[model samples]
Target: MSMTLRKRAVLAAGGLALVAALAWAFSPRPLAVQTAAVTRGLYEQAIEEDGRTRLRERWVLSAPVAGRLQRITLREGDAVAEGDTVAWLQPGAAPLLDARTERQNRAQREAAAAAVQRALATEAQARTAREQAELAERRSAQLAAQGFVSATQRDADRLNTHAARQGLEAASAAVRMAREDLVRAEAALAPPAAALPLSRAGGQAPLRLRAPHGGQVLAVPLTSETSVAAGTALLEIGDLRQLEVVAELLTADAVQARAGAPVQIDRWGGETPLRGRVRRVEPAGYTKVSALGVEEQRVKVLIDIDPDQPAAAALGDGWRVGLRILTLRQTDALQLPVAALFPRPDAPDPQGRAMAVYTVDAEGHARLRPVTLGGRNGQQAWLRDGLAAGATVIVYPPAGLTEGARVQARTP
Candidate 1:
């Protein structure tokens, strides 16, 4: 009877051990997860965009009048001073006149020459009349002093002298006008090979196109001598010291980025990032096709580079740059790594602020916690509520991990 009881107990012990082994093999294991602790710190929201350097003011020098432009001696990047002579222009040759036009011009010239002669003759007569009036005035004054003429007569003589002098001056002015008319008529008849005199070319020796202001030449449209019409662009000039950054931002982001906000300039092929400030947010928006072929409305935001920063000294116009416009910031806020949060299964808020994270409970179980998100940057998220400081949350929960499931810290 004792042997039978011992055998039965041994058999039952072996069966219990086998059943325990099977149960252990089939049981759910604690999930390994990466975790992070929520902390209170400075949080910022910034919009990053590509930008390019551009001059705040660009000046285009153009031909002032229709003429034959001389060869431009200055090359691009040449420094120029205000009022520096950049090029010389000669008045364009007169167009070939038809037979009737040539005859008319010849007749006009002859008429002008005759008018000049008549004006000169009239001037000489007026001069003679003035001399006679002056002599009569002197004689009349002497007569009046000698009691031989009336005072009223002497006054009339003085008035006559003044009128004669005025007539002489008018005749002289007429002669000058007649000469100018004759010069114009001659210019109309001048041939292409004929060189114009100084009087015909506005009384200046040569027409000099001068720089409007001090700047570096950015472009030269006409390097060699050629005939150009009035208002043809000759050179483009701008000061490098006035460089600014222009960033094309989405309309939605532009509205939020106000003027006067601080900006950080990066990726400008420099050793350090540069500083800048928003100068303007252009009111107009333009449509642009994105790289993915999506039409997007974009606005230009002008940034004034801080001239005091030496890092931007070498930057030139049209250089590519990266811009980070700081829109919002909070000094003391609860923040977490963006990786720690995941999309919530619940209906999202209007701003899509609904998000959740799996916080590790004291019992080593993942507890789903819903969080109201505030601001977010590239790598961090600001939480408005639902999570306390120092709370441990899963950074990236494994697939199939459910609420209240046991979790273990992932081995480094």
Candidate 2:
């Protein structure tokens, strides 16, 4: 063989080798994947958050008026009934006017009364004048009709009658004004009503406070020497016998909580888990900034605890409670994880709602199949109307795999 011929043969062999290597790299091969058996299990698609336990209702009693606490029998933690005499208050009296002020006030009252009397007298005189004017007008009108007086005389008499009516109305209004002034002056001199027994401002004479509802007194801050002002919180009472848990949740999670939905309240640091139902999902969400500076809108969800349950007996106010809000529950239902679905490379076009899955065909070739899905939560998706159970489903597909590609499930 010649040297030139040998070099040409070596070049042709190298080019063919390069072409075969490129085709193998581009060709579809077996993809490594994890298989999930389509079996029935708990499916929850939800966002979990730390929930807090709060009292079902807290009632803080305040003083009705300012005064000295005359009598107090009940102590802290004592049960009180409605209209119970929790505290008796000798209310502080209004400041009395001095003798001179009283005398002046009295004088003003008397003047008002005299003015009223004068108005009455004036009103009586006006009524008499109206009667006289009416009689004169009638006489003039009769005379004018008989031709003894001019037609103008009748009009003048009518004008006088109208003037008399106006005068009567004015007199009546004057009498009313004088009477009102007299009443107002008398009321001003009257003493003030009793002050609130318990007040927010601590003073020598504390205001009297009592429980508004029939419950055990949880706290009574008012002491013998402690003073209080109006609307001051003196004590707190709640029906310890009847208690419920109130938990705050993210607004998104709250929407999943349906009314009358079952709640599994657990990790209450109690002996046993308590069962509850969704009583209410607060309609409003408050702006809350989390520790990570996450601006989140949160709402409160109330779970009515059956007090007879074990958790409720051990529960107290402000206990940390966990709530599992169930979105959907069905026995013997088919479901799959959403992560199992992979988009097909040869799929017609991309539409967001459509979910595509690459399933292993009997021929050992990868086939892309379109499957419809239903509601899904945190980890699982409901197999609403597609994908029969007892079939092998692929989960978490490997990269670089396309439809109808020759592949094998390494696990099977």
Q: Note the residue pairs that clash in candidate 1.
A: none
Q: What would the per-residue lDDT of candidate 1 be over residues 185-274, giving only the tens digit for each residue?
A: 786677644535464545434567677667899999999999998679998887787788999999999987887677899999998999
Displacement of residue 21 (Cα, Å) in model 1 is: 1.7
What TM-score does candidate 1 reach? 0.71
Per-candidate TM vs. native?
A: 0.71, 0.56
Write model 2 residue lDDT over 280-337, tens digit each, in one string. 8889899989989999888888766654455476666676777777777766667777
Residue ranges of candidate 2 with Cα displaced over 4 Å: 1-29, 40-47, 64-94, 97-210, 249-253, 343-353, 362-365, 405-412
Candidate 2 lDDT for residue 282: 83
What are the lDDT figures for the candidates, one per model?
0.84, 0.67
- Backbone clashes (count) for model 2: 20
Could you tally the backbone clashes for each prediction?
0, 20
Model 1, runs deviating above 4 Å: 1-13, 94-205
Error of 1 at 286 (Å): 2.0
